[model samples]
Target: MPDLLVGLVVLVGAVVQGAAGYGMNLVAVPLVALIDPRFLPVPLLLIASAHGLLALVREYGDTDWSGVGWAMLGRVPGTALGVLAVATLAERPFSVVVGAAVLACVVLSVLSWRPRPTRGPLLVAGVASGAFSTAASIGGPPIALLYQHSPGPTIRATLAATFGLGTLLSLAGLGVGGQVHLTHFVFAAWLLPFLLAGFLLSGPARRFLDGGRMRVAVLTISGASALALLVRAAVG
Candidate 1:
């Protein structure tokens, strides 16, 4: 039943990501914490990495390699900071951190902020992405916000390229920190099919979501879930 619930969550997240460019982990992390906080950071990272690969395949030609490179350069230290976070924090506290990060992303998304995909901005986004992604598996907002003003294909493709590689770096850092374990893979394996299904559904959903209509709804739901997660963590 837990597996089924998580699969459903991943499916919804993947579909949102497919249509919207960057929302899989943002949607998945907080709700998944409600079901089980331990199924985070690594397991969701694995699923997100897979989703990014699928996104890359469809939009590879549109990828901005220059932007991806700049982001990756900042990701190294960001990942290190993430590793340190995981090594020091306990389960409930870590869950609170994840919830807080998600809340912050939701707040940022609604702001009148319109950051561009310039090199300096991309570097800063990359660093933020790495730290958030490594720490909480919620890395999409920083980079996605930067590329939000770009063309749809460019947004999807560029973010995919950056996240695909960045997720790997995060995994490696977690592994070195002794946080990666066989159990994480076991959980990720359970969500594989749903992730694919969500991507498939994206072709149809993108038309509806492209006009920026869904952004408010998505952010609202994400914020609520994040708040719930924070409450749950605090209570526990």
Candidate 2:
């Protein structure tokens, strides 16, 4: 029953991410944190990596390789910083920070702050993504914000490539810190089918998100999910 609930969450998160380019973590993190904090960080990262891989396979040709390169450069250091923080601080505080970060990005985008996926912004977003993704398993918002104005395919493909590589780096960092365990992979395996289901569901959702609807969905889903994280953190 618990796994069923978690699977459902992963399913929905995948669909959101599949259509809007990002939101899997935003939707999955807080609720999973409530269900089993132990399943977090590692399991979600694994699941997210899979989701990114699926998106990449679907839209491999549309990625912004130059932006991905810059983002990766920043992700190296940002991931290290995140590893250090996760090693030292409690997870709840990081959750609050990620929640706030998502909300802040959403607000800026909503207010017509158009950030392009150029070198400077990609680097900055990559850093934020690495740190947040490593610490809270919710790194998509920073990178997603920059690509929010892009065509749906570009947003999906680029973020997918970036996230797939970035997540591997984070997992390696956590492994070195002795935070990752064999069991986490098993837990992620349990959620894998539902994650795939969500991605499949997202195929049709992409149509629904066309004609600038993807941008609105991105902002709305990200903002609402951030609020949920904030509330969950505040209550506990």
Candidate 3:
């Protein structure tokens, strides 16, 4: 039953991410963590990597690889820091911190504060994304904020490409830290079908979600999910 619930959550998250360019971790990680704590960080990172690859292919022409390279450079050190956090911090405390950070990002994005995607900002965003994503499996907000004002296809494609590479680094960090196991891969495999289903469903809805109103809605949903994680951490 828990697995089923997590799968459904992942399906919904995948659809949102496919259309919006980001939000899968924000939407699904909190709910799925409640269902099964073990199905986090590493497992979700694996699934996200796959989802990102598919999204990138669908919007291949829109990808901005130059920016992605700088982000990857920043991610290397950030990922190392995240692995250290995962090894040291208690789960509840880490969740609370991650939730707070994500909420803060959403608020900033909501205020129409569009930071230019210069090399410095992209690198900074990448560092933050790598740390948060490696620790909590929720890394999209930082990168999403950077590209929020761009065209929908560019946002989706660029983010997909960045996440594809970033997640690989995250997975490697988890593996070296002994946080990943064979079961994580098995669980991710089980959820792949649902993820693919949601991706397919997003094809027709992509245009609809690309509107300004829909972008606001997506940010709201992401904020709400982050709040949920914070509340859960507090209560637990």
Off by over 4 Å in 1: 85-113, 211-236
Instruction: Rate residue 49 of model 2 by lDDT.
Output: 86
lDDT of 3 at 22: 82
- For model 2, residues 51-118, the per-residue Cα lDDT tens digits are 88899999989888898899999889888878788789887787798898789889988887888888
Q: Return the TM-score for each candidate structure.
A: 0.80, 0.89, 0.88
Give the C-alpha lDDT of model 3: 0.82
lDDT of 1 by residue, 1-91 (tens): 8778888999998988888777776578767877887788788888888989999999789999999999898888877777678678775
Ranking by TM-score: 2, 3, 1
Q: Which ten residues in a row have the lowest lDDT in candidate 2?
A: 132-141
Candidate 2 ranges with C-alpha deviation above 4 Å = 87-98
lDDT of 3 by residue, 1-236 (tens): 99999999999999888988888877787788779877886778889999999999999999888888888888888887787898898978988988887788788777766666789999998898888777766677777777767788888898899999998876776677688889999999989999999999988778887666455655765587678768877898
Sort the candidates on lDDT, descending order. Answer: 2, 3, 1
lDDT of each: 0.78, 0.84, 0.82
Clashes of each: 0, 0, 0
**TM-score attained by model 1:** 0.80
